[model samples]
Target chain A: MAPTLGKRKRITRDELEQPSRPPSPSSASSESESDSEDVQDIFRRAFEAKFKPLEVDSKKPRVEEVNLELEDQEEEDSDWSGITSDEEEQVQVVEYSHLRHTGDRASKAEQRAFMSSKPPTLSGSTLFKTRPSTKAPADENDLTEASHLKNDVALQRLLRDSHLLSSTSTSGTSTPTLSAVGSQRHKSTDLHLLSLGAKSSIHAQKNMPMSHRIGISAKAKEREERRRAEAKENGVILEKERRAKKFTKERERGVGGPGVGKFRGGTLSLSKKDVRDITSSGGGRGGKGKGKRGRR
Target chain B: MTDETTQTLLKFTGHRHLPSRLLLSTLTGRPIRISQIRPNNVSRQGLQPHEVSFIRLLDSITNGSKIEFGMSGSTLVYRPGLITGSAEGLGASGGVLRHELGRGCEGRGVSWWIIPLCILSSFSKGHMNVIFHGEGCVTGAHPVSGDLSVDSVRTAILPLYKQFGIERDIELRVLKRSCAPSGGKSAGGEVQIVFNHQVRLPKTLHLLNPGRVKRIRGVAYAIGVGGSNNARSIESARGVLNKFVPDTYIFSDVSGAPFIQTPNDKNNPSGKKKGAVGFGLSLVAESSTGCLYSADVASPPEGGTTPEDVGRQCAYQLLEVIQQGGCVSRSAAETVFCLMAMGSEDVGRIAMGRDVIASENTIQLGRDLREFGGAGWGFRDKGEGSEEVVVSVVGRGVGNVGRKAV
Candidate 1:
């Protein structure tokens, strides 16, 4: 009876450890019987996980938490897709692990494909739709916000760390790996805050458009005004000179009439007397004149 | 004015050979041989009338040879009737007969008489009449007078003057007569002829006073020598006349010798010889009427004047007379140089023989005159031993008039 019991337990731990090795004909018959039982267990768990979607949702899947739990177990048998050929072989390997791994292999594969494809596709659509709007606000705010955000050292440090992590992870993987994913999350959060700040600064830029345009327009207007003012001053001076010349010519023409006659006559007499006195003095207006009169 | 009237008178007192040789040579154009006869050493032997006539013929012939009036044709001859028993011929006749008896007398007496007479009479009128006076002689009569054969001499000269167109105003007067005997044996008598004419002054002294007239005439007389033989003599004579008498017209012979004196020696010391008298006749042609007169007494000498001086003074008076007659105008004074021959050989050689030696002597005298300011007026020999000197006469005013004594 013990020999029969040994024959029924054909899926051994060694075979599971080296999955690539082929079984003997006697062991192959017993391993097939055990593979059927393991397959029934994977199908039942896949159905259970599928029906408990609300539970999964309630649990809030921590990708980091899941990756950490799988780290040690996956280290030895990390190649899961490689064990798909023998379900009993994979069941035997998993039985040795402590984590509750209930999903059927086929169902788990489908879930990974679905999860990976959906999140990236959705995220790409989100990036495409927000880029133009976001860029416009940022550029608008940059002039004002760059001055105001001069003291925001936290945001600056976050952007600098993200940039460094992206640079390091980009060098190791084609797609951003687990490490780059964290940096991507941080970059997204920084972008969201920058968008908020950009919107507020954009409002501030819009408020002062009239004052800036007015400053430029004011300079051109001032130059034109100065030119007009100078022309007006010149016109006034020329008009004054013309009036003076006309007065002088009228006096010389001896057309003194009305009030002008007496005024001009008196001025003329005074000027003539001055000229006569100068001439009679013989260019020595004081001493010589006195001497001549005294001698006479 | 015929050639017969133009006579050339030359006097050689002490010398005879040279004159005779010259005369013979001039006449024949050939040389002649003759014995020399000195006037101071003459003999007293008388000559025959015919012989005297022969000698007179010889004298006429010889004298005619010296007559160079520049007249045409040969000399003329004359024959006068002989003198019968005239005392004037006695001396000459006795002298010739004595010479004939002493020397060779191969020719018959008649032939001797006829030949000499014919030859003498042939040249008689043209003969130069030369008169000589010894130391003391009478005033008129002379033994040489008969020997002179005056008719023969006149005959020779008259034709000569007519041929030469020489005027007949020339007069020959006997002022004194004398001669010296041949052989130096007898005292010779003298005969003087006064030859005179109105020497018309050059037309340069028509307005001078009587005193100035005398001075100008004196200058004119001095210029008369050497007038004929050389043209320079006549020119100088005219020059002299022009100086002192600016308006007196001069009428001169072709020879230009004054009728009073020989052409040469008119100013020499020997010119002062006594019995060698000269007189003048004035012939004034006014309105085509010629007036002839003896002008000797018209102007007397100023004081203590000798005959030579008187003659010169009279010559100046004649010049005044001519000027007064209106023959010359006053403008001729400017062209004259008076005293032109005062030291010139033209004046000195006028009466000299035409010999080589005498010509040389005359050339020397001319050079001396040139050395003393040429031949201007008033030149004089200071004395016998002194050199000849010039006496300047400064003329006043324009035209060389009013000459002041300087």
Candidate 2:
């Protein structure tokens, strides 16, 4: 345990101090060369234990740190691996062409072959260094295995490329109009979603009609205007109107049913008539209406 | 008898009572013979009740005399006997005898008979007959000489007593003498006379009694002049009687004016030179007489010259006599006396005395008696024949005594 503890400390220090190295398989090949089966078994065990509940608690911090370091190395490796794969494909094509051309210059072709070959070797070396010995070949195979992994790789590349392209383009424009359009489009989509949700919620309730709800406000405004006019003409006081509204609302609640309709109809009609009569008669109808409303 | 004597006989014809006849004869100093040809009988027509009582009053003076006379023509005619005659015979003879006596004396030298008879009737009846003698004969011995005395006066007597011989006893007595003081030169005497004897006549001779005769005599002496005094003196004497006399009846001469002094101005030398000396004497005599008869008998206040007080004193005395049952008729007498007492040489005395008499005259005797006597006792003036005889008799008696004292 103490030796492992000293080794973990040395790794943390090395990780912090090192920049990055190129991928190579040689160092990692030694383990597979000597005990390929054992290395495979160990890889499976570490993978399982990393997921185990009991070990998860204990290994979460290390694993998270190693995963962050691995993710960095993988990013670098992927760049280099992409370049090498391209070179290798070019070299193979060249070699095949040269064979087909018997009259070509030998030295120029060899020079071309040496340049393309150098990229694969360098990439392969980087890949071998980061991967375990059992995964070294697989890493090379991963380069060659496009048909099987092409969609993921291409999708990832597409996402990254798009993200990068957008970021780059946005940064490049730095103009207020383009950003405003983008923000407007985002806000409109959010508002569309919110309205759709509210519509559904209201539809679920089903008690209030759209027209009634809308008209209630319009009617309130109309009644308010009428009341103000009546108050102006016959001194139909605002205090009386407020009291009538409150009483009607309370009466609707008191009946414990859909009596709001009846109450609204009665109060609205009576208050309208009262206002009309009071206005026309110059305040005479207040006495009669007040008496009737009081009794009710 | 000669016609003069025969006429004198007629004077005795009408006498109805003996005492009245005797008194008449005495006062006149004449022979008065009375006869009764018929028996005496009381006649309703002979005299009034008061007159009959008056005629009987002389009986008190004469002691007693039973005489009956018939009343003829309101005069008493002597009857034939000294007893009351029958009313039938008095009626038959009274008118003829009264006519015969009046007619027989009317024509002849015996006209003096009518004077005495008239005087007698005047006395008994409370009326009088008076004749004015001339201004009195002043004696030579009078210190101040002028027409100071009255010379002659007519005498009045009752006709029924003309035949009876009785003399009036007028004797002068010096009750007091007020001569001038020694070394002062004046000779004046105030003398008083008393009639002392009573005369008697049969009741058949005259209709009047003796008391009535005395009263009549007293009244006559009060008014008549005795010795000699002027008309002023006689008037003063009458004033004394008028103030004091109680039963006296007064009759004045028809020609005599009530004696009033003439108002003289002292500053006028002519009036002083023509002065009347007897004026002051008469006035003093009147004042002295007024004091003697004053009811209070106290001297009046010195220098207190309210003549009304003096007159009131006189009136009070007269009222006393009347209260004692006397009568007086001094209405005419007082009017005359006040007129004379107011006369003088001094204008002040005359004016003062006139004012006093005027005030005194306003005091009526009848009204005063009515007030004094109270109710039933008051004397009413009964005209001629109705007055009580005792009132006249006592009035004359007191009046005579008061005058003599003065």
Provide the overall lDDT of each model, using Cα atoms, as 2-decimal numbers: 0.29, 0.28
Query: Per-residue lDDT for B44-153 in model 2, tens only?
Result: 33333333433332332221133445443244432211211111233223211111111111111111222223223212212111111111111111122111111000
Question: What TM-score does model 1 achieve against the real structure?
Answer: 0.15
| Model 1 chain B: worst 10 consecutive residues (lDDT sum) | B327-336
Residue A86 displacement (Å), model 1: 99
Give the CAPRI rating of model 2.
incorrect
Per-residue accuracy of model 1 over A185-271 as CA lDDT, tens digit each? 556555656665844432233445777879866886787667667878887432322222444333333344332123454463334
**Interface RMSD, all models, one decimal each?**
99.3, 99.9
Best by lDDT: 1
Model 1, range B245-288, lDDT digits (tens) per residue?
A: 34323222221211222236656545432222211211111221
In angstroms, give how far residue A163 of model 1 lies from its true place: 99
Per-candidate TM-score, first chain only?
0.13, 0.12
For candidate 1, what is the lDDT? 0.29
